[model samples]
Target: MEAALDAGADMVGLMFFPKSPRHVSLSQACKLADMARGKAEIVAVTVNMDLDGLSRINELVAPDTFQFHGSESPEACAAVKVMQGTKIMKAVAVSEKADLEEAQYYAIVADRILFDAKPPQGSDLPGGNGVSFDWTLLKDLDLKKPYMLSGGLNVANVAEAIRLSGARAVDVSSAVERERGVKDNDLIRAFIAAAKNA
Candidate 1:
């Protein structure tokens, strides 16, 4: 959070999914966002949200960035981006080369694309699974704009991920946690340190 920002994280995220252990109540997330706002870009991570839902979140935390981590259509993302008046980073799961194809549809619509691991079909949660794919899968491929590499990233391998994938921006949720959802400040610092050096 504040520590990660001090370590040079341009942005920090707060999860809002009820099903996720990382989920935060409005007041809880608001406080965290308030603390991290001036230091770093605050991002509210949501999944399959409607306009009204998005409005509620937009008003509550007022995150500088919004990350849609679900199976949202290009039109849906575009509409949200326009409605929120904020930059939107649409999260897409990438496992194979074909997975990169979906990035094309969002190239013009989204402010950025977040490549994460594909969730299992029956999994209740969307992301934060700590599942990673081969970095070689993304080597040398370009889609323009800024992009984020987000699946299973941590202090241990973030440098390698950046070197192999050529992603300037990266995100993490589960990897910084000590338990399933409890974020560890130490891990967060270590991750940012590793990423900066990368």
Candidate 2:
């Protein structure tokens, strides 16, 4: 967490879903969030959790924003915002042009949108799958809410990815890892430097 903060990361993602390898327990996540409180925005990433579940997390983690990466409807996203009074970032899985349509639906409900690569069939995880979609698909994307690009991003290709997608922001996970769920300080620094320079 300190490494990411020192690298000048604007936001840090903390998963709440146990199914994800990156998942952190509520107490652990809250502790980390507290540590990064003023340094960086903490995002609580979740799947198809109910309002009660979300309420619990909200009370504990107090994230700056909530990122819905599951099959959450626009109403559900809106409901979460009303309930927690925190910003919401909706993740749309993109494998083809048609998938971009989902962003249109979420623009009305979310504060921001994240365009991530669609996970492989039967994959347990949603985002951070180390899979990338065709960047050209987002070449001319223009939406009411700003969107960030995610998936398969690293120091080597993040600049090209941003150039091709015209993305002002990007989210990376597996690409900077020394192993699954274990982040490498060197890779994190390299990625931040490369992205900023790009």
lDDT score for candidate 1 against the true structure = 0.87
**Residue 98 displacement in candidate 1 (angstroms):** 0.3
Give the alpha carbon lDDT tens digit for every residue of 1-198 in model 2. Answer: 888999999999999888888999998998899989999989999999889989998998899999999999999999999989999999999999999998999999999999999999999898889999999899888887888999899999999999999998999989899999999999999999899898
**lDDT of every model, 2 decimals:** 0.87, 0.93
Predict model 2's lDDT versus the native.
0.93
Candidate 1 Cα misplacement greater than 4 A, ranges: none
- In model 2, state the lDDT of residue 185: 94
Provide C-alpha RMSD values for all models, in order: 1.3, 0.8
lDDT of 1 at 44: 90
In model 1, state the lDDT of residue 160: 96
